[model samples]
Target: MDGLDVLADETALLLASVESLDIEDLAHPSNLPDWTRGHVLAHIAGNAEGLGRRARSMSDAVPRSMYESLESRSGDIAWRSRRTVAQHAQALASTQADFAYDLAGIPADRAGDDMEIRLGLMVRIGDLPLLRLQEICVHHADLGVSTYDWSNWPPALVAWMLPRITASFAAREGFPVGWVEVEGARISVGPDPTTGVSGGATEVVAWLVGRAPGSGLAVTGVDAVPVPPAWL
Candidate 1:
């Protein structure tokens, strides 16, 4: 299956998980610092709405910003947080469907059209789906539920993300500049990547995204494996 198909399946899983949660469970803290599960769901729905809006703008050749402001985003999430778990689940599912609907009209040939994202940086419209997939996959695990983990990620998604994420790390300022080996696949990042860190692809992705400690990874040519800052 293609990445978008895989994303659709994964999103179904996430929706099922959210739908299964008890109303009280919404108040529980998520893996992200200081945010509750409700907050996470709210953000997910809000993101879908934002991306859907952008897709519409792109398809129609209309100019629109993906996000109004950081403060507006936070406020919207806060407003959505007041809803019950069922309400939040409905919102997430509806917004996700809307996003998929919007994307259906955007063919690959036109996906590369320039568009501005939340940070005011312009990027290809084609990148929107991948970004949404990342959010769903990562945040599903972040719900702190027993069913989800780094290893639970789709193998295709893992393979696809490995190079992109490592390349992003390599491009960052002050990155440790090292070799990361994930289950025999080795990638060198930065100008002089002298140190080598080896581990399972799951652990590597988790650590690279700041979602896990590097305890499971083996390090060589360095005193310790440096934890990277949260991915942008």
Candidate 2:
């Protein structure tokens, strides 16, 4: 997939969702625990800025950190979440554009180069676009906008992300030992397969990533579907 092209499209969709909200709506609670719509927006903007720095760091003789520190990153999110609706919109638009510009400037030959992100984790320069894409798409849903919920995620994005997301969830400390059955493809999330959660790919992925409540899914070997660990 042309990651940049996909990222641009998703970003535009997220921007429109944000633009649709009134100033008073910013204070409303999001799908995420204890975070208002404003908090999600602030995090999205901060994420774009951080990822943009990572993209630019790939070419610098001296690479820079994605964020100064985890505490500072959290602090910035808290601080910026208080901005007026217009300020939040401007921050979101500008940071996304800067991120795209920085990501596009990296040479194809340097796509595999690694840069440090939050908590000293390293990611490939070429992966920044998709990383930012995930952030925008997921947080856009986090805004608790019914029109832009997980069900509205682009099919291409879900297809590209499902396997990776399942793998990541399986690796989490307390994930259940079971299989995730989607469209006849049974993916083993843990050591055992006695339990199974079957559903459409998008719904399964959404539940696995804590983006949605697992409803209308068929479950076996357990009274109810087990909640997976947090993805992030």
Candidate 3:
């Protein structure tokens, strides 16, 4: 997939959702508990800005932190969340444009270079676009301003993310060990499974990631559907 192209499309969709909001709408609570729509919009802008900074550093061969500290990141989001709709929209557009440009300019040889995203976590320079795509697509739904939801996620994005998310979730402590059946394809989530969940690919992916409840899914060998812990 042309990750940059896909990222641009997703960014546009997210911006459209943000632009449709009014000042009052921004103050309304989002699907995410305790976060107003303004907070979600601010977070999306902040994420783009952080990722763009990383992309610029990658192109320059000067390593830089994605965020100075977790506290600063939180503060920045809270401050930006109070901006007018126009400012929020502008920040989103500009930061995303910068990220796309910086990502496209990275030296081909550096694509395989590893960069520390957090204290102990590292990611390939080439993978930043896909990571940003995930943030935009998932958070757009979190805004809860429209009919869009997990089912609206691009098929290619869902296919690419489902297994990765499943693996991450399965590794967590207390994660249920069972099979996950999506569209007739059954995959073992953990060893010695005694239970299973079945659903369409999008629903399964959303449920596994804690973005959606187990509405369209079926549980077998268990009294209730297994709910995954919050995804990072």
Off by over 4 Å in 3: none
lDDT of 2 by residue, 1-232 (tens): 1477888888888878888888789999998899999999999999988887877766565577778888898899999988887898899999988887877777788877776676645556667777777788888989998679888777767886788777776765556757889899998787677888999988988898898779878897888877877777
- Supply every candidate's count of residue pairs whose N, Cα or C atoms clash at under 3 angstroms: 0, 0, 0
Weakest ten-residue segment in model 2 by summed lDDT: 115-124
What is candidate 3's lDDT per residue for 1-232, written digit by digit as tens? 1377788888888888888889999999988888888889899988887887788887786888788889999898888889888998999999888878778788888888887766755667777887788888888888986656777888767887887777776776666747888888888776547788898898888898788898889988888887776777
lDDT of candidate 1 over 192-218, digit per residue (tens) = 567888888878888888877879989
Q: Where's the lowest-lDDT run of ten residues in candidate 3?
A: 169-178
lDDT of each: 0.81, 0.81, 0.81
Clashing residue pairs, backbone N/CA/C < 3 A, model 3: none
